[model samples]
Target: MVAFDRPHGMTPPQAQWELPFFNQHHHTLALGLADWAGAQRVDESDDRRACREWVHKLGEAGWLRYCVPAAHGGALDKLDSRALVILRETLAFHSPLADFAFAMQGLGSGSITLGGSDAQREQRLRAVANGAQIAAFALSEPEAGSDVAGMKTSARQADGGWVLDGSKTWISNGGLADFYVVFAKTTPDAGARGISAFVVPADAPGLDTSEHIDVMAPHPLATLKFTNCRVGADALVGTVDGGFKLAMQTLDIFRASVAAAALGMARRAFAEAVAHARQRKMFGQHLADFQLTQARLGEMSALIDAAAMLTYRAAWMRDESPTQGAGTPAYTAAAAAAKLTATENAQRVIDMAVQMFGGRGVRVGEVVEHLYRDIRSLRIYEGASEVQLLILGKAALKT
Candidate 1:
């Protein structure tokens, strides 16, 4: 693991928060978060340890409070999409791992927030808000990464309880999570309609999370295996055979925030590129003095701005539009567009930054090099770019 020194005085620009899409509270949150995120530094050589530390710090500072609702220790009355965007973007600008840790808290427990029983909410949401418990969402299986309905995991009734037998892979916070919101098929023949969700503790009797996966970036992933894992009836999250909708609902809420995260990374890369251009001497002058360098910087700036607008628009639509709830075609398309544009554009902008850095860009400890690895997964997860394109295409036909 290589640690790159954070450049001094490098912070994401706050001017965008002044747009009509954001309210004063959003601006206030951005300013406070920028200060807090800028001041914090953790040793990220060990990805798991760093993730745990970040969750703890974020919770203690009351930032994780935004992950849930005020009724359950959150700062807001509900999960505010704009606030989530601000928090993720700012944190990601400083550290992508921090953003990942923060995001999983909302995503892993999101179903509970949406449909958990009163008892379930009291038990889990509060603990999650406080960081006393870590959470993971187990949905993707080896064969079901993009096709949620193709999952083979099953849960059957047995002795007043449910017995789950299946596997989940590419699960973030897998080995480290205290509990998992595991989705499995309850009606083997019903496809997506057959799926159900359960809250399974990490220490559950037939559950295995010891298989850790190593990724190109600093994310803790694992493959989970369940061999007749049993949980009480109370463990079921939402209505029986409704896990698919609940899962999509949960993802919908965080989809725009994913775009915000990518925007943050792109801004960081752009900042690094500009700073480098101003300092690195070339031929007879600074790199910034060259018209070619200026042109590339202009292109990078335009890309970042375009991504930012899309990201903020998606978040704003979710937060402010009465009709923009999950499953609504319009909002869904907007979010898909944002995710697709931001992640793909971030990759391009980061690649441009790497090119500007020349040989130093590919060096192990270089910031752009780390960013190159960090930004690739964003395009694939939380709905791939191809999936987003299909969403937009289908939406266009509907219109």
Candidate 2:
């Protein structure tokens, strides 16, 4: 039995969030969430509904409050790195879909939480925190995967509001989100500086979810089309031409959390593999007795520990950076490093677990199989490994 001191009555702990970087409060939160998630079951059928349900559960449990500010019903005045780490690790341990559900709420509404006016925060963030609404971050376009400046989504001046006309592809929670924080180009000639952000409600006229992209993981994802979708002047987030920086900064804060989620998945898979090795015997000896198997297990543990350190360090650097509001070059570099290392190492760790399972690993319904699928998108999303490498190289050259 696990020694996790869960509050009141809770289930077994799958994985704890305790680390040298986390504080006592973070440790308590991690233990509680891990216990809670361990008791929950993931329904593979209707993954969208499952994700929505998970969001509601997280909200009811008061975990969703970390997505917003205290003035707007959140637990903290701003998003805290440690809280994010704890939440992601716990949610991911239960179900990656659940983690995605909780994460998009923060990603989709983070801009407003960081730079929105009081009215926007009250209207959007409060409802989101209360689970009365779901949120989406619409930044990727059909043509602009990693290159934000190349996006063609346009926002033109209008009588009472701005008219958005374009399409965003591969948006997480696209078909499910109650609202989206969309980025559009307001000035054609100014390039990236021409972009602006807007809070587009799901019921906004002329907005349509054109298509749902079926992925291997089978969560809610879609392409959103805005054909002359008009939003009020007050819907503009932050300042015109400042959306790019805001989006980048928002991503910087959450990137390490993505790594943390990946790490949790790796940790679960590793534990399962280890258990299997110890329980399963081959050639009159347990699989754990094999020298090669032991070596693989040792390597997997080392990789997971290293990934955890890098991921936590990145989150800590963001929280402790000198420039509170503006993004710091140092923090940016550290975050990129963490994202790069954690994602790549998660891939390795998951692969090792899959290998350890041998033929059973390739089975369609196996836990290792599910993890294999869950981890693929982590590398591509947020920022790709190649992209992170380039970002780090550019930062180093500048220094």
Cα RMSDs of all predictions?
1.1, 3.5
Q: Which lDDT tens digits does candidate 2 get at residues 42-68?
A: 565787787788788778888889898
For this target, which candidate reaches the highest lDDT against the unseen true structure? Answer: 1
Model 2: weakest 10-residue lDDT segment is 1-10
Q: Give each model's whole-structure lDDT.
A: 0.92, 0.83
- C-alpha TM-score for every candidate: 0.98, 0.94
Task: Give the RMSD in angstroms, all C-alphas superposed, for model 2.
Answer: 3.5
Instruction: Tell me the lDDT of candidate 2.
Output: 0.83
- Candidate 2's C-alpha runs over 4 A off are 1-18, 323-326
Q: Candidate 2's error at 175, in angstroms?
A: 1.2
